[model samples]
Target chain A: MRLDQIRPGHVFLLVLILGATLWYLLDTLDTSRRLTNTILVVPLAILVFAAGAFELIREILRARADPTTLEQRDVDEDQDSDQTPVDMLRGVVLLGFTGLLVFFYPRLGFDLAVFLFIFASLVMLEPRGYLAKAAFAAIFTLIVLGGARIILPYPMPTLIL
Target chain B: MLDTTAFSGALALLGSDINIWLVIIPGLMIGLVAGSIAGVSNTMAMAICLPLTLYMDFLPAIMFLTAIFTGGGFGGAVTSILMGIPGTTSSVATTFDGYPMARKGLHNEALGVALMASVVGVLIGYVILLLVVAPLGAWVIRLGPAEMLLIALWGMSMIAALGGNSLARGLIAGAFGLLLGTVGMNTAGHIRGTADIPFLLDGIPLIPAMMGMFAASQLFTLIGSGYLIKDKTARRADYGKVLSGFFQVLRYPVFQLRGTLIGVFVGAIPGVGSSVGNLIAYAQAKRTDRDSESYGKGNPKGVMAAESANSSSEGGSMVTMLALGLPGGGGTAMLLAAFAMHNVTGGPSFIDQNMDIVYTIILGNFAQAVLLLFVGLGFLAIAGNIVKVPITWLIPSVMVLALIGAFAVTGDQAGPITLFFFAGLGWLMKRYDYPVAACVVGLLLGRMVESELIRTWQISGGGELEFFLNRPVALVFAALLVLSLLQPAITNYLRARRARQQD
Candidate 1:
């Protein structure tokens, strides 16, 4: 493929393969194979990278045959994000909230963290008032935790519901 | 071992066990609910629900999990039909024709078709299992390491077909999966890629990784869409259309039979499951059908072929799990782990001694399949409304469910963390047109293939010619593997030649 024809997706795929390969080689060097399947790890990585490299090289031939095909397909792929600005913001906020939930649940306790997450989602996802958000969040938490209490083991964890 | 007396005794066991009977409905319900939701796969559903089985007796626990497995097999089609997003990878093929049917105002009909096909598939699969479990189990015993290695090779060969349109991308994805799956400690007790993190000793958590790939990544893609169903009115449940679609499968016995046969055989192979079966079955149905061109355009037969194959995979998977102690997919792998937890092992001797328990599980699945007709309709009617929920609300809420569900799996932070990492990975794969299914197949089968190869190497002991001989089963499977790889090319070539002749 030409330099301009090389899309970010291709670069990203190459980087990923490289990362996997390096990691496998480094780890295998550090560890010794015994009665285990460790011997196959690096070979597996090599095979994968080889296939990926072969795929990329074949794209070169295909591009030569149908010059526009590669560029058009790459553009379509790179355009996966079709959201409007407002919609895009909403998605970003949701992803941020997920990160926060994962980071804080252990520190905040499951019920508190989960309830907060639900309330925040309700408020941001729609134009609900504060009382409505709180009510919705409360009901959701109660039902979820209440059922967990009944079905799951008790003395939950870290004062979790 | 599977004489008439054993069959009747198995029936008696199933009838006598009210506990097993009661859990089947609940299990089916749980599976249906979990599966109908976006991002929450049937495998993740089983993994999350695994803890619940801790309280039940051994037989009841296994039966309950199996019911979830059975119920989950069909539940995913609901989302695939009504919503464009597949609830699980196994249901991905359903989205091709199913979503089109729904968009064209045949939503109820599509769902009904999926339900009917799924039920018939399961019924037919179990019947095949019952007939072959004993003999197959005995035959598999003779398979040896050489044969098992060939089976894994066969599974890997299917990855080419899975790449969607490109064999190169599929092989790359599968290789990535294999490497990722091998991150944990080798059988020799030496950790390979733990990065010094203690939890990495088990490698990345499979269930969490799957939730990320199937659920979170898909959710990310959906954040731009206003509604899952554009017509909006199609979101509502129409009982009349559902019933009509349900009976539609009866009109296509041929599709049902072909799909079920494909599901059973493919699902029986370790490391290969419904994902490949559905795709292959749909491809074959399209290839042979008179109205082939209408396949991906809301054809009921397409829906039937895909759903039948996938649902039948549940039985096919159970065959290897119960008979050979081999897991065909993550769900069956979970079953094998449950077997260990309950101090129950399933193999030739186990089945021979506990023939009644074996029979009970199969019979219980049959009951679950019949029960699914009612339960699934109610579920589709209710869960089908998910299309009405906006992306803003659905995305975060699903992430929350996934987080909690992941936390529940590991009882620690590793689950949620892995969920985050894989979500990003899955999204990238999706965005780039890479088949994440190939990666999942690689992950699922990686360990099995590696171990089988090692065992084969040891047993062969540098005498390749001797170990390779005297194995008729291996030879047959080897032929099947090669044929499966070439069939697509053969079919495409013929189609092209026919077009040229016409011109």
Candidate 2:
């Protein structure tokens, strides 16, 4: 329950998953109480939420019990905090650019969207030699277009998206 | 069961097909490249390539898809070894040791061992199929919904995944996954967790979600690194090491044979496929090894066990499909779809009537296994260069390909959206030390679990729980489930008893 005990990643997931589960459960109030609704979805969702919630409680409680040697549970094993500002910006930029690409993808078509996404992503990654990056992106685009046209059986592998 | 007529018929089928050869190499390559990509699976590759089979005859069509399935078996292993990312559910267990080996600069040997084990595993599975498919088919059919439920439950118990890190954490992850899986719908046509989103009515897009969780999240971990392989010498891509690793599989005969047996039997069960087979095979290997301490820390035997079982499951799944009209897993499900497209039926009667055609498909896959050895080497030699790519470029480029692949699956923004959502979820889960493999397994089996539970309940005479009491196969599975559930406790008790006796 203590806010200090939780990490940002956990907070994000707990809020997202719990919010969605509750939102769906509440939406069912408009419908009839069917077996699938009650016996299946409600209990399963609650159990999943409870499982995650329980783990958090256990961590906090265990941390409190061992007060003699305090260890901060703030570090994510996969994340490295000691980084240049540029390294941090690369992640943020890559994520934001991908979101934009996904949003624009419906209108631009697959080829244009993917080409732009790749080019922008490469540039944002701050690769050396701008011309080489552009050429690399162009070659990758051509290969993708060729593969989509010739190999895949879909009628519009690139065009549909 | 092989009459002279059927033997000659199989020979004629093989001799008459030039189209078969054309599709074989392409299909294998497609499966390999796609499966080796972090998030894309053999099933996804097979699904995309399934339409190509429509233009061919029935036997060749079956052969082509199975070739892809077979090649993907190893293709997935390659990525798992070199990249610390499992290419598919089956390759999840491969990472327990394969990735460790890669980190230790043993990636070449790991890849070679995986390839060798897969080739041998596929060969063994078909050999078993050739011998006992009729009898095995008949027996496999006797397994009802209850048995199927037990099989699914058995898969759910693969919580000792990633080398028994933390059983509690694994179970929580699996439970969380199963919940996500049951989100979209119930058999009664009610959408459960759509939250008024129409796109979610079909449930979460599995492939995209999987791509995000496995590929994107793992890429995030390597964001600051320069290359996949840290050692300078390992980056050279030596064929000599590859050959040595290929032969190293011979040194682990016990692991190979045990994994092969486990693969075929578990893989033959409908609804459970190599996803369970690879995990169970790896778990068993870990449990029984004399040098168990070395298991999760770069053991070649672990790679062999996982790769062998997953690849050979191709034969195992084929047995279930051809003889029972049931899909053994996702890959077999695609094969069954091809069967329908070619206007061919699969089941007991299909085999009885077309014994020659059945044998022909089996024989064709055997040759495909031998060809996989050569083709895999050529493929790996090129794909191995991925480790040399700078991490910054690698992450974004691969992520883009993964996004495109996701789009290709659902043909809409739903795919890419799901991919990103799951990638974030996967990142959080990974950050918090939950087993993503357990979650993926749960997602794969959650719907099946619900359906079979409903069927069991309905057939139990309006909620009478005693319906399972009289079924022999169900009883056997029930017993096995109990034993599996108690295995750790039982082992501990025995170990304690021996220690007390020594005192």
Q: What TM-score is obtained for chain B in each of the predicted models? A: 0.77, 0.88
Clashing pairs in 1: B39-B215
Over B223-332, each residue of candidate 2 has an lDDT whose tens digit, in order, gives 55677777877786778999998889998898999999989988898767887789878877876665767987899999999999998888888899989988888888
Model 2 chain B poorest ten-residue lDDT run: B159-168
Prediction 2 TM-score vs. true: 0.87
Residue-by-residue lDDT tens digits, candidate 1, A1-161: 35555555556766777676777767776787554545577677777778777866665554455445555555565564675657647655766777787788778876787778877876776765878778767776677656554543323443445
The top-ranked prediction according to DockQ is 1
Looking at every candidate separately, what fraction of the true A–B Cα contacts under 8 Å does it contain? 0.61, 0.34
Model 2 CA deviation exceeding 4 Å by range: A1-6, A24-35, A40-43, A55-68, A72-89, A153-161, B1-27, B37-61, B84-89, B160-172, B286-299, B326-344, B462-465, B492-503
Give the alpha carbon lDDT tens digit for every residue of B1-503 in model 1.
Answer: 34677779888877776898888888899888767664456776677778778888887888888878877888888767765556565787787789779767788899899999999999999988887887765564465767777766765654554566566677778778888877877545667778788888877877677767656546766666766566766667788988999778888899889989988877776666786678768766766676766876789998899999999988888888888888878899889888888888877778778877777778778888999998888787786666677665666666766665566566678888888777767766766677776787677667667777777777777448666776777778778767766665687889999999999
Q: Name the DockQ score for candidate 2.
A: 0.39
Clashes of each: 1, 0
